[model samples]
Target: MKSKERAIVSLLCATTICVSWRGFRSCSPPQDQRPCACERCLSKDDPCFMKRFNKSVEPFLSANYNLSEDDFNWWKRLQHEKGNFRTFRATVARLFLVIPLSPDVLEPSPDRCRTCAVVGNSVNLRRSHYGPLIDFHDIIIRMNAGVIKGFEADVGTRTTHRVMYPESSVDLDNTTHLVLAPFKILDLEWLTKALTTGFKGRSYAPVMVLNPAFIRYVHHTWLENKGTYPSTGFLALILALHMCDEVSVFGYGADSDGNWSHYWEKIRNKKFKTGGHPGNTEYKLIQELDQQQKLKFYTGF
Candidate 1:
């Protein structure tokens, strides 16, 4: 009788366990097993990023407008802490892909019919007369007021973005995206000032591409000795890699001839022969990157 009672209890426990498991499945099904929502179905069919991107760039599409509350809050937060924008990690505190970066807005969408040209501040491109070809591209990113008439032939008249420093002499406009290469406390001060009315004009909210992210990426690939600043041209190329599907590089240091002096400086009565920029090691590095077809360099450099 004792054995029989023990068997009965075991049978009852097994049956209860089976029922509880089925009930649990009914309550919390696996992702595949669960009934899908319409939103989930649509999400699987479409990229969530596209909708988010459309919402982000709506102002740019409409007109030169004020920053949104969400944009402001997002920028304000990243303005202090910080990724593609990350290519290294040195400290344990460092994280990658933390935030999508500069709000992940499509600069120019498919329907927008925009081609992009990233002009570097290399002295090698002085008086090259490549501006027309460059302007034909669609959106031109020029640094330090590198402009010429009839030059918008290839790239376009739209100086869509200007990568600048407080010390830079570049003239900015609505489309300008001030890229701060912050290294210290004072750097933050200057960036904040630009974002505000400190520049003696209607304040523009800059894209705030954290150089620290690229700084890390440089080290990730280059290791401890990532080479100084790795050339703004290199940074520009990396930017293209992340944000653009197709990108063209202009006024870069393809000058193995070591000739320095950009076309802009020549207009301002500066020496065209001045070798502007850091060590040649970075130049060689950029050349290698270009050779790898990471970016298309102007044939004439």
Candidate 2:
């Protein structure tokens, strides 16, 4: 009689477990299993970043004007504390005072066209006579220590945005946007300190850091997370796609002699090439993009 009663209790417990599991499954469905959303979709379907792009110069159909609250949160969540003194979340909390959560919005213009010029530091730009054409673009994105003081005639001087790392950072006026592309957590801290407390006894002079989510997306989706990170020029190109409706690339690829050199620097015997970066692959990708008619590519003389 005791054994029968014990078996009855065991059966009841089993029945309760099954019912509870069914309830749990009903309450919590798998989010990943669901279909992709239109705006949030970062895959091939989205017209903006489609690899097979073939369109003329027009406004970005669905440009993200500025980073949203969710984008800021993603930064905090994705930044991992790997063998660090302070956690990423903790550091971000302290750094929030100086850094703007979202970048300045690119206001819609109904009258004028929004054109962009992505100027690379290739030696082919020398004597290219692209200055007049470059200045015509509404937005000009220059990366790293891309100086215009000496080479203004070749590569226009009117700079709307400058993208750089901590080492390559430069002082900007109130008009030009200093876009900081952070590689590590320290980069973010440096920006905050440089603007607020002054880094290394000097100031980076108040800047706007790029959205971490955008960086991650470019690294994983576009770059396939291959090397240490994507080049700043490549990053700038992706950024142009987001902001400008019509984009033009100038001063990319090697010179006629098949040498990689910057227009600003003098030519050297040894060919200048990318180190720790897939330059060949990147070049092919850029060529493909141009062939697709998404943008115009001017191979400078």
Candidate 3:
């Protein structure tokens, strides 16, 4: 071969070896020997937050309320930790059955754009006339004790999902999903009991519990554990990001007069602001997210 041709061929061979070596490293398996092709699948410049998030919280998804020593130890650790959780271990253990793990209820689909509306109970919703608009979404998620009965004109009556703990448990219709945000083992127990046998002389329709990992994600990563944990509405918005292609948040924060009251309730004083929750911080965060075009944040009408 001519010297020039030999040089060109040698350069091409070296280039191929370098490319192949990098590809192999990028496709290396993770700790579980499962393919960890994230580096190859996602561009480094592209912000793949969701992909990173799912990987980070995989363990929390596997947690179950089984009545075993390990399960009891897990609950014990959570109880000792500084957070908002009501202890109902004794009551829950009395049920004498390993609570089966709930399936992932909010999996994403590839073909459709899942629109979601996270409706908070703030009084700002009153006279917003967003009822019809709110109802248009594929999913309408309401927070704890968020009523739509009388004020259906302001807040839509079409509720696809309701998020609550044991204290805020409400009677859900057959169609609406009951997504439980368990703060403690008792909350999980209450959810199981509510769906199965009656708990505290009351039973609810079948319910789904949020993956503990997702909840932990919202608390540690999103809220930075700002105030014990993120509020129900805040957590709901985070959950929406995972399940929906587009997310619209409504009825969050205080109203015009700076009073934090429910749309259905009459505001007596400004003292009704969100207690134990960093409302202002959360509002600012929501606004920042809006500025980034991650989601639409409607402060009011």
TM-score quality measure for candidate 2: 0.69
Query: Distance from true position, residue 62, model 2, in Å?
Result: 19
lDDT of 1 by residue, 1-301 (tens): 9999999999999999999999987665555643332112112122432321222222221112333434333333433434211111211112112212334345533334335588875655555666676666655666645664444443345666665555654556656665554443344455544554446565443454444434445434432344434444555555554455456787666345555555444344343333333445555655654575445677453
Candidate 3 local lDDT, 130-172, one digit each (tens): 8898999988999889988888878888998888877886777
Order of the predicted models by TM-score, top scorer first: 3, 2, 1
Query: Candidate 2's residue-wise lDDT over 1-301, tens digit each?
Result: 9999999999999999999999986654344532321112123444645743222322111122333445444444443424242454455566666655545646434333467899998988888889989999888989888878878889987888888888887767667777877655787677667777655454332356665667656656677766555688887887786676667998777777777778888786665677756666667778877776656788887
Candidate 3: which pairs clash?
none
Candidates' lDDT values, in order? Answer: 0.48, 0.68, 0.67
- Indicate the worst ten consecutive residues by lDDT in candidate 1: 84-93
Residue 149 error for model 1, in Å? 6.4
Task: List runs of model 1 lying over 4 Å from the truth.
Answer: 1-104, 107-115, 145-156, 219-226, 254-257, 267-279
Residue 86 miss distance in model 2 (angstroms): 6.9
Q: Each model's RMSD to truth, in Å?
A: 16.0, 16.7, 7.6
Instruction: Rate residue 283 of model 2 by lDDT.
Output: 76
